[model samples]
Target: MTYQAKLIAGGKIVIPAELRKALGFQTGDSLVLEREGDSIVIKTYAQVVREVQKEFRTMVGEGYSVDQFLAERRADWGEE
Candidate 1:
């Protein structure tokens, strides 16, 4: 669904009530704005986190412990 919103003072735009309700957004909810090519994308924080977690779950790699990863990064830093 698409909706048109006018840019208010200070370049702020308000999300339509219907759209917000459909997306289950409350007054205090947070949204993230990201730039993609020539378009700006907006998504709720929860939505972004869910997408990231889903992507992480699908990733496959050699099994490594936190200590191992940290040690490797520290070595790269070279005796900072």
Candidate 2:
């Protein structure tokens, strides 16, 4: 779904309501913008959070944990 919006005087572009709803964006929500050559990419904060969560799950599956792993490392480093 594509919609057009006008850029304000100060160069602020308002995201279209339909697109926002489709992407689960709300007022005051954060967004990240990236440039890829001549194209631009925008993503919601929630999407980034979900990606990070997946990465952390993979790390935990690789034998890392908040408490036990840190304690073991500290013991090895003689800081325990």
**Highest lDDT against the true fold, candidate:** 2
lDDT values, one for every candidate: 0.83, 0.85
* Model 1 bad stretches (over 4 Å): 60-80
TM-score of 1: 0.67
Superposed model 2: Cα runs more than 4 Å off? 56-63
TM-score, structure 2 vs. true = 0.69
Q: Tell me, by TM-score, which candidate is best.
A: 2
**Candidate 2 — which pairs collide?**
none
Candidate 2: tens digits of C-alpha lDDT, residues 1-80: 55788979998989888888988889998998879999778888888889887898897785666798789899999998
The sequence of per-residue lDDT tens digits that candidate 1 reaches over residues 26-75 is 89889999999998888899999998766765673346556776888889
